[model samples]
Target: MQAEGRAPGVREVAAAAGVSRQTVSRVLNDHASIRPETRARVLAAMEELDFRPNRAARMLTTARSRTIGVLASSASSLFGPASSIDAVEDAAREVGYAVTVAHAASLEPFDLGAALDHLRAQAVEGVVVIAPQQRVQDAMAHLALTVPSVTLHGAGDAADEGVFVDQLRGARLATRHLLERGHRRIAHLAGPGDWSEARARREGFLAEMEAAGADAVVSREGDWTAASGAEIGAELVADASITAVFASNDQLALGVLHAARLAGRDVPGDLAVVGFDDIPEAAFFAPPLTTVRQEFAELGRRCVARLVALIEGGDLAFEEPVAPVLVVRESS
Candidate 1:
């Protein structure tokens, strides 16, 4: 057995194969000039020595770690972001790349800088920043990125090297669904005002309302938590004029459901509610939730495809963004 500190190195493998270290390196790197007999001998030597190439050493030679760094925020803990991250990991692995994630303490430049520094030390070929907040975006503008990087969920109108859920369209779908149900005095329970998705969703909600000529524009902000949702949900529907609600996320919608029940309001009878994300538990709610579904799996696949392109020097247009799907349930 190899000692922990004496793991087989390239020199050892080359010696065992009776070849020079350069020959071993070329064989490992698939240089294509090596003869098949020599390659087979090297492979047999590696199997005998159980040699694994040092990643750092390979990085120095090839200038490619073949790894991607993910600088994520609270999104990693949330359903949407977590699902997207899982998708990215799967997609990255499929394309023969490894993923390393660094969660920022906050999206502050200092925090983001620290995460970037960590990934750079690992010699990653590129980075994906899931900057959902404007503050993160603001800090990102001044930071110097040495490797190819792409921002996600933060780009404004311009279609850059990033991807975003079409929140505006999603919000419009939720709002229009309510409007079609004959809900005119509908109120919006939004996530943190600081989030791009939150702002886009709010904008979509208002746009749809105005387009439908619905005069009511009631709205309140929440922290994307059920507690915040419940607290604000109570106040949002207190006026009795609001017959329906469109929450920015499933948690907020759950809060609305709880609040309505506490107020003796029958869901979809006295007050209808809709949420976003279509989280796994959304359907299991007391009444299955009516909500907008962001294609997180697709979101992940595209980010990997885009970032890989950027890394490989390809300026490929990604497959178009998949629009959000509306899941109509008993809630709305």
Candidate 2:
């Protein structure tokens, strides 16, 4: 066994296991031809000597950096994308890969092109695109990237291998929750039309309303911001018949909640409110918000896992959209 203080080399491990350094290297690299007994002996020797293969050296020799590129939205600091980034990093580390992030604040064609070029230059094995804007999807469609890539919150055309939370289902859940509470004249505060997630949510809400045979569906557009929610919420509150409102996301929901307070409407007793994305602050809202929760982290991990598998020439499967869960609380 090699001394504890001394870092063991390939040669030392090879000698201890009665195998050539080349054979040990091949085994460590997951080469299929090595005998089972030989591989086991080499692994045992490595354990005894506390030998750690130098990743940098191995990467240099194999021309495989074992690094993945993440093209996250510039607005990633916000709720959805930020949580996704964290999940991607966690999954990558668990699988023995490192992640490099690029913030493409704008989804313009030129910006996405430049971002892809930058990731290619970094020798990334795969890429996970985290932007879902129409412009971003258009930019991604134009890029001629040969590297394996997947997009989060993307439409079917974005990538054959990608993952997205079921925004439409979440919207339906929120609307259904409100309806079950006996709110007939419910309103929806939708996010911008350019975002795929927003569109999906809108579709879900409309579908649910149509199915329920509701008399009318009132809607207002928001920019997925607290201020937008507040502004639109005020309009919804102006109508005495509007007894419930569903905001597209938590920030906007918070704004709606504020607007409700400003309008002096008692929640649940006089009005019910539901939001999507169940962000951390949703629970702490003035009356504790009832919202739909999308597992942003799970979405990120799936994106990275699928892209990495594709990069490694492994099987890739398109999974159904992950379902959203409704968190019941005081607000609704």
Error of 2 at 329 (Å): 1.1
TM-score of each: 0.85, 0.86
* Candidate 1, poorest ten consecutive residues by summed lDDT: 154-163
Q: What residue pairs are clashing in model 1?
A: none
List model 1 lDDT by residue over 97-205, tens digit each: 8899988877678888898888888778889888788888788889899877777785246665337678888999999999998988999997888888899899899
lDDT of 2 by residue, 61-109 (tens): 7889888898876677878888888889998988878899888747677
Best by TM-score: 2
Give the C-alpha lDDT of model 2. Answer: 0.83
